[model samples]
Target chain A: MFNLFDLGKIFEISSRSVKYVFILFIIVLTIGLTESLFLSPEDYKQSHSVRIMYVHVPAAWMALGIFAVIAFLSFGTFIFKNKNFSLISKSLAPSGFIFNIIALITGSIWGKPTWGTWWAWDARITSMLILALFYLMYLLSWRIITNKNSANKISSLIAIVGAINLPIIKFSVNWWNTLHQGPSLKIMGDTTIHSSMIIPLAIMTAAFALFSLLIFLMKFNTEMIRIKSKGLDRL
Target chain B: MVKKVKLRIAFLLALILSIILSLFLILQSLEKDVVFFLSPTDIKNLEEIEKKKIRVGGMVKDKSVSINSNKINFIVTDFKNEINVSYSGSVPNLFSENKGVVAEGFLQDRSYFKAVKILAKHDENYMPPEVKEALGDK
Candidate 1:
């Protein structure tokens, strides 16, 4: 089982790739941390506590990003009937749900200090919660349906329908008056954030992307190995 | 083969379109949903305050809580300082006296808060950190 690839060659290649990606991840994390923690001045309104935005904002961004990827994967599986695409998408669901959970938790934590409450039914918050729920339902759909074709078809439909929530989540605050504050980094007529803050945020966002990529790749590889092993066992 | 190709192309197109649309929406929402957390003390010092929306956090002072139908009145205190909060809405499961609470709304005439929403602490130990920092200790 372990003798499929040249051991030394595989080790050398994997280690090299891992090192490069890890270094890049570190650099992005450092920039994000430095900008958010040190370089960016305290908000005129929120002061130092506003720094939590660095973490909260990126997590929220990645949550949606991962969902979008999953939705696409689901679509691919539905159209092409590719088992690999479905497996990859299914693998991503748990991670996407985890990120969504993190985003909601961090948002609530940030809300406690800023909004004075832990949660609100404000459009954005409510919609994000719905997004998380949808991800969970998609994951559960796989468990309930043993037939691969049926499971893929149903979950793909769920993913597509749930995609509706993404737009609602984005525009919720604007459509209705909400307690959640408007954008800080970008604005229509004016930008309130300092350059120092933006730099770190960009870095952190990149770091988060890398981190997510690493996780997805590892999960994909593990699934591939499992499938291969099962095939070998049948032989 | 043609049918499969069409499906693949359609899926790819949908994927690209949805991704672009989602990114646009995420960017747009960030403009409004992102904001800073504030303590009760910070809410007090504003001179030109009007209908600006904000959040307030503190422990619900014991015995100061009053309920009349759907309307509820509670005093949030940081042991040394306190603010009166009046809210009329569906309360969360964790709201109670001697626990941390955060109310969202605007200050009315520099004295009372006309809260449109309220959030209760989910646990015993989890007060908003900003509240703890503002209150100094405990």
Candidate 2:
């Protein structure tokens, strides 16, 4: 008598929190999209295609951001011997991997029009590829290890080691001259970007963050439920 | 217990340091110059035309295409209008007549696109973004 409808109870627990998050997500998205799309004047150079930045850059940011979170969770599990932290890390893997893939794909698509090439082995590109590989390895490690305790120990170590790649990815462009262009949104001294452009970018970033959080929450809840139901069935 | 606590503190410190470092790098990248791609129509409307290296994209109009030794000549069509394009470098696999392409460089004397590089689609099914934009206009 496993009814899929029973899943609705999961939604009921934090319904208020979800609603508030959703509202905030929508507001952020609206502001970001409007600023980037309508209000921001087209680049004196790029024109309309510059709009793709609203999507491409934020996704790239999140791809890196999620991995950072994963590293922290992995470290916590390793140091504190916390199963909950390990579960959170495991839950985040597939989504983080998917985001990185999306970022690379969109980046390639954007690069074709802008860089005149679909693929490049530049520092940023190469490091991001490595990050994607780390994600795959993390997932594979989870699958291969059958013993729960041993798997947790090994995976935690792997996650910590893989975190080294994050710093390399972040500094790749600066460390080496590469085809991949540097950041254009947030700078230190001189930001020539108009408020119109910045606003949409901010909105899109917020939307991306909310979307990631929503997915994480949903996935975490489902995993918990599955574990609980399996235990009940055993009883 | 004290050793474990110290290790946990160290880990947390490392995490915070990494995040701040990433933020700094991203901010640094934002300061670097960014280039843009443009089509012929965009060039016509642009005010500061001389300063930027813009990408001109369209199709190589049939019959307007010519070749001499190393240089190639052709007219890029936007369906409703067209512009002359000339390039001296190796063309991409997708360069052909009536097919979409993007040329990177600058306009010479407001007449011909003196392309420094040429990019072409790899397959028949693919359309360049500039072409898609133009097609969307109609």
Candidate 3:
């Protein structure tokens, strides 16, 4: 049972799967791009500007999803005292941070043409900005701290604290009068988006998820190799 | 080792609970201030009017828009209450009758507004022209 959780085993599996994931990511990405760019009809109002949603929405979702995963793994690290958990969280952070920045930039670009402003201090927008800051602080904490145990503890604490902002971000539009619109796709409610738009959005989201997983596997394998080279049995 | 791990997990949970409580209280206290704009009803229910720059957001009343040489006049309504807004600058492309809008400016009186900027707010529903036509939605 313990061997199932061993770093070597994790590394072997990730390294083996990276190429397959990459090939699948490329295939999905090509289909997703073609669908979103050409097949998906332009918005009745926003027209071609609405195409930005394919990238912006998926990037935002991945950023939020990755951060949630990090926070959960950090909690697991504290309980199990598993260094592997922290290492996995560490590997996940860079992709999450990159996605966060991508979401913000793409959102700003989309906002300029649609909302008539590049940015606003709306509730949803502000909460997302705060989340990006949390990601930044989490990344910086790992770099600034020298001691291994202390670094893991501090970073985990930051992630746990930052988890508080996740619901705030999710509910910001509904909770307050924001310039941003309410969610079109709801898990428990009716989806306002049409099937034509939904198909591309779904495909693009899957492509992004696969891409992030590929990034995670590469980063995780590199960390494991580093540990093995140093002759450490476990993290 | 098990006892130590259990204690650590308990402490982390307590910390999370306390932090959540603090955040809830803070957000509750700052509720009104955090809102991006006030609806017409919200503005009407205010205790006292401040002579400050504020934003009023609502739908542009159907067929209430009138454009002059440079100035444009429109009525913004929340269906229960309405405020008449007049602006001199160009409005966003999305600004039109029966669409959501936010006007930033000063309130001249209970029923009048002087807008410095007009921002069109689109709803979450997205569909192509053909789908909209098929559904007979405007």
Candidate 4:
């Protein structure tokens, strides 16, 4: 079935988007960091330490968003059973894992001075660790399982099942009494965080989202190349 | 087509079963590790202290706090009820009267709590939502 899923057009689009987003990501991230460090108002209580929110919140948001994307892509794998969906899901794993790690590390660091402890077995922290495990499992399945078809199905299944953690992580603070504060911005209600902090936060979150897309495109390009080389063998 | 349908059923069955089993384990661990916070009223409502660690959060009642050589004593109240809390170590910078505080340790009784650690939030204008709901316009 020489099914090259519109190879030339996809390559052209991904390449162009990757270049555009990478430039945007760098410029936006620099501005976000500069403002976070210098321009944002010092919190009346934590003072300089409260600035950690700019880094921690955006990383946490990206971690959750990227995992949701993986689950969506995995769902696509099952319905379409298309190799392209599987490839995209696999491509997403590394960046998601890195973002998850960033969230955990920054969270721990931020917790020490504010919460008076480095970490606690609170619902929010525990659920996030489970998410990191899911990311690790999805990535490891790709490397350890030799057969490409079986690996694709297995990793997709892992992603699909691992989606169970997403909702738990989102509501962990609300559902249980945890030290981690309730979300700064509620879906419906007024934002509790100050607008000064929100500006840097919005900019930082955008930068992380763009960076995630750039990394996924780069990884997807490599996966496409691998497929093309293997297809050549069949010819 | 019948064979493919049977295979799909088997696959889905396995997936559902494993998910249920994993969920059971995750919840079991959560129960074991979950440290729930209770307000002063909940403390009054409890039959007895279980000796297992628990967290108590509320506003520190005004003038109910006393400091002495690294040891601090305070009353955490939800307007309608209160509990006396004692701690030997440092408290968070925000841990003062009229501020929101969460103390983790054993309850000596319904009226007395011994805190091993004290956590104070940095949000000057904020209280833990649970504390706010429990206190209710107090």
- Best model number under TM-score: 3
Off by over 4 Å in 3: A1-3, A232-234
Best by DockQ: 3
Error of 4 at A62 (Å): 0.6
A158-209, model 4: which lDDT tens digit per residue?
Answer: 8888887898889887777677777878889888776777899899999888
| TM-score winner between candidates 3 and 4 | 3
lDDT for each of the candidates?
A: 0.70, 0.69, 0.91, 0.81
Every model's DockQ: 0.06, 0.05, 0.81, 0.30
Candidate order (DockQ): 3, 4, 1, 2
After superposition, the stretches of candidate 1 with alpha carbons farther than 4 Å from their true spots are A1-19, A185-190, A232-235, B1-138
Model 3, span B1-138: residue lDDT tens: 889888998999899999999988998999887988889998888787859999999999999999999999999999999999999988878888999999999988778889998888989999998998988854
lDDT of 1 by residue, A123-170 (tens): 678779999999999989988988767887889878876776786777
Which tens-of-lDDT digit does each residue in A50-116 have in candidate 3?
9999999999999999999999999887777777789889999999998999999999999888878
Off by over 4 Å in 4: A1-5, A230-235, B1-33, B122-138
* lDDT, candidate 2, at A204: 88
Q: i-RMS, every candidate? A: 11.6, 11.6, 1.0, 6.2
Error of 3 at A143 (Å): 1.0
lDDT of 2 by residue, B77-100 (tens): 766656788889777544677666
TM-score of 4: 0.86
Docking class of predicted structure 4: acceptable
CA RMSD of each candidate after superposition: 11.9, 12.7, 1.6, 4.7
